[model samples]
Each structure stands twice: as structure tokens, then as C-alpha cells.
Target: MQQITGREAAVAVLNDPRFVVPPVPPGASGIAWLRATVGRFSSGPAHDRRRALAVAVLDAVPPATLRTGGGHPVTVLARALGIAEPVMDLVRDVAQAYQPGTGDESRADAAVDRLVTILGGRHDEPTAALIGVLTQACDATATLIERARHRPVDEVLHADPPVRATRRQAQVATTVGRVTVQAGEVVLVGLAGGPAFGAGPRRCPGWDHALALVAGALARDSPSVHEGTPDTAPGTGRD
Candidate 1:
């Protein structure tokens, strides 16, 4: 068997439109890459985790803007993952409170309290660990914004030249306006000069790359039990 890196899996998602519209161009090793990335696991718990984490990362946005009040992306993703509504809410609340410019550290505590209350004492360690992971994701978003502070608008959305485009794949990366990477976290800088944070359907240039990035990152970050490590199953555990 060939070794598959998280990045290559991400690239596959970018190139596959059945996964998203206007798929990124299929690369030279498209078939091999696709098989290595998507064929690793049959549909199972692991697959679900991979999907859920993919949604979370690809759909990331500011909490307030992400529509978390009952019927929003958070709820949708939570449902997809089979997690209780309350748990998803708690995660959203905590993330919202901790975000900068939202003001007030007290809110974060409230969010944390709600989470603890929902999970109860026995789940403290697990809750803490989960919270830490979510917090890291939230922080990653912040870091990306900060890094793009000085770059030109066009430069931000620009992809590297010589992208992998296949005859079957739709145009990808050609219409991109900007791109941003903070540490290892990547965010699309839209043509409008706004961070394509949770862009609504019409606004997002296309999420193939973004979704792939999120899926790959979540798969990499998650433990085998949570969302399967990148080199392993890429399962869809509670992540």
C-alpha cells in the first residue's frame, strides 16, 4: 500500500466535484491520489468522523456570524455527527465567548460552565480535552486573520501556479481572489477583500480546497478515537 499524507487527501477533495462544485483540477497522480485518500476506508464510524470534521473546518466562521441560534450550521454539523444539540451549543458558546473583539472574558466562563453542566462531573476530563481542541481550532482562525494583515488583497487569494487540474475536473483555483495561511491553517481571502469565513452559498468562490483543508486538518489533529489520525482510518468519531 502507498503512504497517504493528510495534505494529499485534502488535494483529492479539492479535485472532486461530486464532493463540491467546480472541483479543483485533477492532478497528474489523480487516480492514485484519489484511491489512496478516499479508498482507505469503507463507509463506517470512521468515515462519519472524517465527514463531520471536514464540515466543521470547511464551514468555520465567527460564531456570531455562523448562525448558531438553534437552526444554523452548528446544529447541522452536530446532527451530522450524531452529537446532542446541547453539546454542539456548548461548543459554539465557548468558541463565541473566547473569540477576540467579542469582548468580556466572563462570557467564555459562562460558555464553559454550560458545557460542564451539560456533561456533568464524570465527563470532566473528556470535556476538558474536547474544549482544548475546539479552543485550538478557534485560535487557529484568529491566527490566520492576523497573518494576512499586511499582504495585498490579490496576493491573499492567489494559489500557487501549476495547480493540478484534470480534464474531467471543473475550474478550480482560477477564480480565487485570495488565500491565507496562519501557521498551518488556511483560509481563503475572497475577491471582495473579505476573509471568506463561512461564506454563504453565493459568496464563497468555491469550498473544494477549503473543505479538503479542513477535513485533512481535523483528521490529522483528532485522536484515533475522535476522528482518526490522518495516516490511519480518517473515521468520523465525535470530531
Candidate 2:
């Protein structure tokens, strides 16, 4: 709602620390969208449009801004920036629900709500893929939630990667690492830098955001769990 120029707003957002992730090592795929959007607003149309674009971009693929690789310095800087990864997962859930092949309207709608709560703003194409990843995790979590609707999660576990992920569609693809599954909640890890699944603090903030977001989703969708009932139901159990 603040009426700042796009260039100014983008610069401000980039510097906000809530968005920008720590820079990863070379040979890693940085967020192309974030770099381009920032470049565009760096010098483009009027300030209002730039501001709107800035807002849209932030609302869209905010996860791109989260720092993933580097070291404690980056993590420390990223956290100081308020640029944690779990928040991005909330954006992702809503984006994925809208995907064409997902085939679950309820899930999509729920994702949209989750996105709204997380971003508290609009959406765009740039953020769509990230959202899709969130949605996938939501779907997988939903699957687990449904299976263990009456159970409690005693422990959180993670599974090592059995195979590498292939790149093709606009989904979160991993090559190295493992998959995380806890009480039917499953996610990919160790791809690129950080399992890229939103687990640890030093890895891809995108995945971290996704994991936190899905955990919330699972709680909401299952009243029993939300109400403090134990999740004793059997689940995937991979961390």
C-alpha cells in the first residue's frame, strides 16, 4: 500500500533482508527472476509502476531473495535481513495449487489462502514455479495428514536421496542429496547446495520456507492435529 517508486521500492526490498538470500557459490543457479526484476526496476518506467512491480515481485517469488549457500556469515546476514526461507514456502503453496497438472482444486484453494497469509499481497508468473513447489509439498503433506489423521508424530526423520532429480518442468528439481519425510510429510533435500528442500538454515531458504509452510498446512487441514490430538497414525516418517 505504500506508494514508493518501483526502482526505489525494489532497491528497498532488495536491501530489506527479508527477501534477499545469501549469495551461493559459483556454478550454482542463482535466482534469475530476482536479478532480472531488480535490474528492470533499477531503471525503467515511472516510480509508481516500479513500485507496483516491486510489490508484485515480492508477492510473487520472494523465495528467490532468501540466501541459501555460503556459510555462517551468510546465514547470520540472511536471518538479520529477516529473509528466512520458511516464509517463501507459504508463497509456494498457493502457487502450486494453481498449477494445471496438480488436479486438486481444494488443495489449490487452500494453498492460495496459505500464500495470502504468508505474502499478504498479490501473485505473478515469476512466482508461479516457486508456488508449485510449495503446493507439491502441501499435497504430499496432505497425503500424509490424511493417512495419519488420528495419529501423533513422535519423531522427525529424513531419508537420504536414492536417486537424483531430473530437470524439465517448472518444479523444484534436485540432483544430489536426500528426501525428507516426516509423518507422511515428504520433501527433497541436498540438491545444489542445501538439500534445497527447506530444511536446514544454511541451505536453500526456499525449501526451508516450504517445509514450515507445509507443516502449518497439515495442522490446519487436520483438525485433530490442530486441536492437540496426538499424530499416532503411521506416516512416511522421513525428516
Candidate 3:
């Protein structure tokens, strides 16, 4: 395993074709199924397809311009995804196990089951795409809000990002920032002080949506200003 810290090194690793996201276990159902099926854990053509699915899901769902009385980011995202009942707890449960080897799989699996039933059992990749958008936005948006309380959202993202490190596997032995990473080695790419939204093709596709959510949320939490505008103003090229 290699821990890459330099900004150039992280960018190189992220942008390089030789490095890919660590693959999640496949051939199983529930959380395993979700991980295996989602773009986050895939590469090559499959990754492109899955990523397009996720992007299409986000394309229809509009980010909230302001944090309303009942505006939780998760609920906002869920409703935008066309889920009549955006069960926060279920989303939270699944998000707990969204990442590989992180949360209680059994609980998350059950949550996925229930959530699926709510979605009318559409087990196709679009369903996975919807689920992925909601779960990914849940915890990540919340953390960004918390971290930005005493700082600007952009500054916080740069100085103290919620996702500090991301893992990549070297597909071939390659030199990254003067360090030689062996094939199949896990490279921990540090995002701190690096590109906040990442660079290259596999970079996160929801950063603009994320910023809108965070900006709205933080504005609501402010003592003097309860209502805030979205990240993009009226003239700011939203379309």
C-alpha cells in the first residue's frame, strides 16, 4: 500500500489510466450488489455506463435553493429523485454501509430491501443510480455543512475536506511523484490541500450539487440569516 500526499502526485494518480478505484466484492446481493453494480467500484466501460446512469439521475433532481423548515439534504435529495417517501433513516442506514467494509451490512441490506420496495422494486442500474445518489449525498453533504460552520464552504473544502483520502489500485507498475507503485498495489490518494473536487474523467460528478446543498444548509444555520440563496445566483449560468 502506498500513501500519496503531494498534490501533483494525487492528481497524477487520480488522472492516470494506470490507477483505478479499488474494486468492491461482487457476485452477491444487497450491499455487496450495490457496491459491485455502482460506478464507484468499477472501471473501463462498465464505469462509464454506471457513471452515466448516476449522472442521469442527478440531471432530473434539482438541488434545493434554500434550506427550508423541513429541509434536510437527504430529504431534499430523496424527494428530488422522485421518491414520494424519502425515509431519512433508511437512507442513513444504507449510507452507513455505502462504502466498502464500513458499516453493518446486515442492517444496510435490510434497509436496501425496504428502500427497494418503496421504489417499486426497480432493480435495474437506474434504481442503483438513484440509491447511489441519495446515499452518497446523505453523509457527505452533512459533513461538509458541519465542517463549513466556521468557515467558507470553499475554504473548508480546501483546508479540511470531508473525504480526506481515496483509495486507488495500480493497474500497472508506474512512477507517481518520484515513488514507484507496483502493479495491484493500493495507493491512498490524499485529497487534503489538493484539488477539492478532484481532476480527470473519474472525478466526482456531484460537486456542484453538493456545493448548492452545503451553501443552502449553512445559510439556514446562521443566526442572522435563516434563508440563503443557492450556490448559483440568478445570472450565474444555472442551465
Best by lDDT: 3
Stretches > 4 Å off in candidate 3: 64-69, 222-239
Best by TM-score: 3
Ranking by TM-score: 3, 1, 2
RMSD (Cα, Å) for all candidates, in order, is: 16.8, 17.4, 6.7
Pairs clashing within candidate 3: none
Worst 10 residues of 1 by lDDT: 228-237
- lDDT per residue (tens digit) for residues 90-194 in model 1: 554455433222333455556666655554533233444334334333322222222233443234333211111111112333221232212222222112122
lDDT of 3 by residue, 1-239 (tens): 56888788888888888888877777455778877787877889998999999999887856553244236677767766667885778877887777666668899998887877787786667777777877777766667777788787778777777676778889888887778989899877777685666768877788878888777777677432212312211110000
Candidate 1: TM-score?
0.28
Q: Which scores greater on TM-score, model 1 or model 2?
A: 1
lDDT of each: 0.31, 0.30, 0.71
Question: What are the per-residue Cα lDDT tens digits for candidate 2 across 95-180?
Answer: 23222233344544554545433443434433333333333333333333343433432112122221111111112222211222
Model 2 lowest lDDT segment of ten: 161-170
Per model, how many backbone clashes are there?
A: 14, 33, 0
Error of 3 at 200 (Å): 0.9
